[model samples]
Target: MMEEKMEDRNKIKTELIVVIVEKDMSGEVIDAAKQGGADGATVMYGRGSGIHENARFFGITIEPEKEIVLILVDAAIRNAVLCSIQKKIEIDRPGMGIAFVLDVAKVIGSPHLNLMSDITD
Candidate 1:
């Protein structure tokens, strides 16, 4: 029975939120997610677009500042992290940034295995 339960737990799906924000605000975003109970996160520099376009002054392109933060969390904490990020980053405002969730089907890492070990016992 314990073995079966562990297998089931391993099969459970998790959600990952990929957030892109202004370079300066990345720390606030990460802190918000941590307060919301995300286990871990990864951040990197990136560029993206939406309804807004780059501003131009005298025909010079004004590149918008950007940073990408990827957070992997169990499904149970998805909503909390989402709401916290939205509130902290003011994603509803223009030029703020965007965040979206994706399904993580499988995870491979010793940490993940250790996380499941207690269930197997």
Candidate 2:
């Protein structure tokens, strides 16, 4: 039936994983994701605020720096990638940054995939 085919196709859809972590941990986080199942990741600088702010030892104020990593992966590997990052970064603790998965409606510009049209004239 048409519905059955649609459901099967959806199984291979892609998703986006967003990880915000301490600036220095971004590299390790991405590496763990790649080892788990993700093909690649894009990281960028960012800043965030939460209940637990950094404490200053002296007169200077220290705002923690953060890095955001975006990873687009096949839905099949979403869970594995998330777990790998969490295990590597020890995200279970309170102050560590957060990570979430979003259902990606579409993806583009990834050079990692090679497709075959398979059309004969």
Candidate 3:
């Protein structure tokens, strides 16, 4: 019974979508993702050292500031969310940004997810 319950709980697979964009773009990205079916996102500030990201100032190189947006959503909507983000930001263009998806093995401490599972069960 426990095994079956676990399987049922795990039926809704999760995916993590990570978007790295120029500074101050996280809000736009988050809005796009939400429009694409994502619930929410987490944003963090970072710096990039890519060749195109470095700017020379007074003979010194300054790494471009970046914003990392992390969105976790059900696997079923990953593609739609990615497409929405691409449409909004043109992430494919040079220096625009980059986005990737990763399979999430496990997730915890998410009240909404827990509530969803309870409602489904």
Candidate 4:
């Protein structure tokens, strides 16, 4: 049964949707993602050092605060969620931050996986 469960898990493909946005905008992005079929997401605080992150005042460097949102979803909903995020945040604009997707080979002990299985079954 253990091997059977592992095989079932393997059959489910997953993807990670990563969105980096200004700290204040994280909530809006998460809401949009949910509208697009995402179950939920994990957010973390961070600082950006990219070209757009450079700001100086009184000759002192400033690193803008950022929020990194990580959302794991079934591969089937990846595109829908991405599109919804872009539509809400307009990430394509300069200084609006970025969003990307990564293929997840394996996911262990994630409630997101269980949710996906329930939906599929």
Instruction: Score each candidate by Cα lDDT.
Output: 0.78, 0.78, 0.88, 0.86
The candidate that wins on TM-score is 3
Candidate scoring better on TM-score of 1 and 3? 3
Model 4's alpha-carbon lDDT is 0.86
lDDT of 3 by residue, 47-103 (tens): 998977778999998988999999999888999999999999999999899999998
- lDDT, candidate 3, at 117: 41
Worst 10 residues of 1 by lDDT: 112-121
Query: Where is model 3 poorest over a 10-residue stretch in terms of lDDT?
Result: 112-121
Point to the candidate with the largest lDDT: 3
Give the candidate order by descending TM-score.
Answer: 3, 4, 1, 2
TM-score (all chains, Cα) for each model:
0.79, 0.77, 0.88, 0.86
Clashing pairs in 3: none
User: Which candidate, 1 or 3, would have the higher lDDT against the true structure?
Assistant: 3
RMSD of 2: 5.9
Candidate 2 vs candidate 4: which has greater TM-score?
4
For model 2 the local lDDT of residue 58 reads 86
